[model samples]
Target: MRVSSLLRFRSTSLQTSIAKQQQYVPQHKPAVQDDIKRLEDFLISKPNILVLSGAGISTESGIPDYRSEGVGLYARTNHKPIQHLEFVKSSSVRKRYWARNFVGWPNFSSTQPNATHHALARFEREMRVQAVVTQNVDRLHTKAGSRNIVELHGSGYVVKCLSCEYRIDRHEFQTILATLNPAFKDAPDMIRPDGDVEIPVDYIENFHIPECPECGGNLKPEIVFFGDCVPRPRLDKIAEMVYNSDGLLVLGSSLLVFSGYRMVLQMKDLKLPVAIVNIGDTRADHLADIKISAKCGDVIPKLFDFRKTNPL
Candidate 1:
């Protein structure tokens, strides 16, 4: 049989799977079979679907997101992410940030993609998805084998010289960090969503932040930090992907951040179908053609199977 024949999802089995994963399902408004059916229909109708993902998708992978209620980093703690201007302007801030990041790096770097990420990768492999545009700095999608991806906020897996634009893999940078802070212990209160931790002031005072070896300039993670704009070229690329796709499928994002929210707006402007599968109300809820309040991990893995639907 053709591989396309395996794409149809058995509704009863899918629903049963969703029901079995109730621990991961949202309590407020769990997704019904109808919602899955609609989404399945949407996927079949729109072969070249563009996925716009956010932090929620990685939460299943043990990384915290900033905005989810009660469980998110913001709700659970008073910490805020490093702002771009602050990191650029203050030496002390960078010192503190790097110290925390050094402590948290191992745990953050070890995070593996969960079912949602794997499912998205499968979608791309099956030619159902064109690309995944993620606001997350974590490269979980790529780690999960998604090749056609646009890291809208850049990635934590890369470091760059702010002055000269020289880039290096984050692993190599971490090795440099290890050499610089050989005495630093790995103790942390907890790892924050951005792969940093709340370290003691003493650690910050003693920590050595690495400068770019080639230029003696500041080294920064390639992520688009809060209060910074996404580079124009990345925006253009995402726009091109958006224009090329027949529909938009949002997974695990509240879309409160304008960077991810604007994609939904663009899809609406293009008169394309927009389907969202998230736990709570998203900024684009009113505009979405279908909004299913369910965990992406629970629902996404069941999206592809053999049950018979219109051919893509």
Candidate 2:
């Protein structure tokens, strides 16, 4: 699927008022015990499992995913994430993005790692999972104490100067942004994935975005925006992670994006055991040795519940 279509922007005219928009409450099919048992058995058979996680893993933390059945960001709203090229080429787009992000950052940045993240961390500590490659930019795995992690999409917690390579903590950048546009106190219509939100255009007309302190150039989040390629160096690192693993376990991702989907293909090519735990069908579902359609939170913690007395 083309990235542009995946994140197609909803025109301003089509946007409904927040009060008029139907609120999306997340729901999932009840997890089957049989599937959970199968996943546990799969994990037991493979000592060095590589975990590939996605946005669904973070949804239980109160963040939203992009493609969950009825509660995903795309399903809830007409808006989609910003296109990287548009952000880089248009000052107006940057202003609007920063404005909306500024409104949503407090909640997004404060989101904590949930049960699924903690369970994954425990699996890593026990040596059951060798590495975690996450498509999420939220950095919840780091917060959950997973030592070895590869953020397939770069983090949302860092900002970089596009022209000068200068970097700043996202918190510090938020402060700078706040100081620059003190009058932008407009409340957000809704919070989207990656700290983005839907805000009125009027709120953006006078919004002031800060430039790089060093080179007076553009400041952008460190995340790989929609329609952008993951840096080659990062890709190489992930490739090495895949090469070193004996098993592949997907957590909470639809694998709609090629980057994550390619890893599953690699696992198949290597003839490694592959399992997936997601709420819906994934692009690589047919190839998965075992596919469980359920929430990661409901399923991941149970893996450890069965092992609590036994210990891995």
Q: lDDT of all the models against the reference?
A: 0.82, 0.83
Name the lDDT of candidate 2: 0.83
What candidate 1 gets wrong by more than 4 Å, as runs, is: 1-29, 186-196, 306-312
Q: Give the alpha carbon lDDT tens digit for every residue of 1-40 in model 2.
A: 6767655544333344221222232566888999888999
Measured against the true structure, the TM-scores of the candidates, in listed sequence, are: 0.87, 0.87
- lDDT of candidate 1 over 262-312, digit per residue (tens): 899888899998999998899999998888988787678878664434455
Worst 10 residues of 2 by lDDT: 16-25
Off by over 4 Å in 2: 1-26, 186-198, 306-312
